[model samples]
Target: MIRPDDETKPFVGRWNSLIRILLVESSVKHVARAAMDYANLYDGTSCHPSNERLARETGYNERTVRKAWAAMRGMGLAERVSHGVAHRRLSDEYQLVIPESWQSLPVLGPSGAKFTCVHCEKAFNPTGNCKVHPDGRVTFDLIPMVFCPEPRQRKGREEPWCATEWDGQRRASGETPWSQLGQERWKVFHLARGEEW
Candidate 1:
């Protein structure tokens, strides 16, 4: 499982955010979950696992992984930055994108929007860096204590919800929206909530 405070691999926090708030087909979500293991440390976006590897990891067939990738592309959740060379045995490189639309949705445990920096009042991009100065100036330079979306400075008396908690309880209990519960249960929960499956 990915952890938020794994400083050696800072991308875990972004992957956590992706899984927590993802709203897509359950099958695609499963693929995405598996791909999280391969998120690059430089940024959470660069994923380069082969389709066969992803299929094996997700316990799905290669065909399923291909379809899932197509669905992810259509949904703007991921993009193939480089095609693999079959002769050279290179795997396709994909970048996982956090859609701007998703930034506005309410998180599972809090009323406030996801991906917002408490200090600067600006949304944190996928890089998990906050470039906004205290006086409201954005800078290209790196600054200390400027990480965002996780393990960063937050307002007094408020914190992000722990996504790992209650995964088997509340999400399985059947809830509305059917969007915050991560993978494989979306369709069931959606149908349970009186929506067409």
Candidate 2:
């Protein structure tokens, strides 16, 4: 299992805030409990806990857990065991996944939101840098972020969540975003205007 450590600490703090709070709300707490049950599947050996059993453990009504499970499925957080009969749930294979919207800038620079990567597993600092062409046109490089489901940093405390390196291929020569990232594994994050961001 991917134990939540310093590498995953930072991003989880920033990105998980809303989801954490939301997951604990009204119907959502059931969803959270179910997610935890699903996560238990990969704990040590494997868990195929039934949704029914999960409800019993979490104090949620069976029907309510079912509904919450469906909602979690839509959010890309949980999946059914087979066609759908079992209470056993499936978890994301990669375990960490960041959405594009979270890694993006709505309007180029400052107007954009900042996020940490689930894959790269780090939070970009000061300001999240542009992952695109520094030539002015905003490039959409894959920014490092988090899934925020594991043990992570608390709000008042933060750790590293920047992309030091990526697992995939390097970009073609002269490709700004890829090369810029290559300039240093620890990248100098900048904005669309190429200033400190």
Candidate 3:
């Protein structure tokens, strides 16, 4: 008997904020999920999964898998690392590019007036000092932290509803986020949060 788990790889490591952001903006849920699954299997820079394998793992048809792959690549989430093997056709490797620095710009929402986070669900106004891009566009650095469904537990303190504390930490650590910790420790921290390996 071919069990469902047998067809799918264990999801490990922290999901990239960019992927979550894309999922919110994606019109097709299945395709977004497929993209996420592919990202979970990514090894540092790339992952190699045949269409058949992705279809089996994501429970989507091969055509859907191909569409999902193309969509993700088009959205700048996945990049083809290599072409198919010569003569014999083979799966192409893809690199997952997670956006680290996301700009916060003003966008009109259903409420008519609100400053929403360009990357995620969180909302914040673009005040204080802003960075001006080469195209004459301005952006803020008040991006929310990566999504963490569980509330943070602190001694004698009320837990916050969402994971937004990373912003301060990132600023304190200088321009590069997660630069304070070593790579190994960072992985461990992500694992503790239920992120994939």
Each candidate: what lDDT? 0.52, 0.37, 0.44
Tens-digit lDDT string for candidate 3 (1-197): 11112324322232333333221223233544555565545343547767777777767788767666665564444678897783586878877644332211111222323333322445442222233345544332222222334456788987654334554555766744443444443232223222221
Candidate 2's C-alpha lDDT?
Answer: 0.37
lDDT of model 2, residue 136: 28
Deviation in Å, model 1, residue 25 alpha carbon: 2.9
RMSD of 3: 15.3
Give lDDT: candidate 3, residue 138.
38
TM-score of each: 0.46, 0.33, 0.37
Model 3: residue 85 alpha-carbon error in angstroms = 3.6
Q: List model 2 lDDT by residue over 142-192, tens digit each.
A: 232222223367899865423322222233333344445453333333321
Off by over 4 Å in 2: 1-7, 10-19, 23-25, 37-47, 84-197
lDDT winner among the candidates? Answer: 1
TM accuracy, model 3: 0.37
Models sorted by TM-score, best on top: 1, 3, 2
Most TM-score-accurate candidate: 1
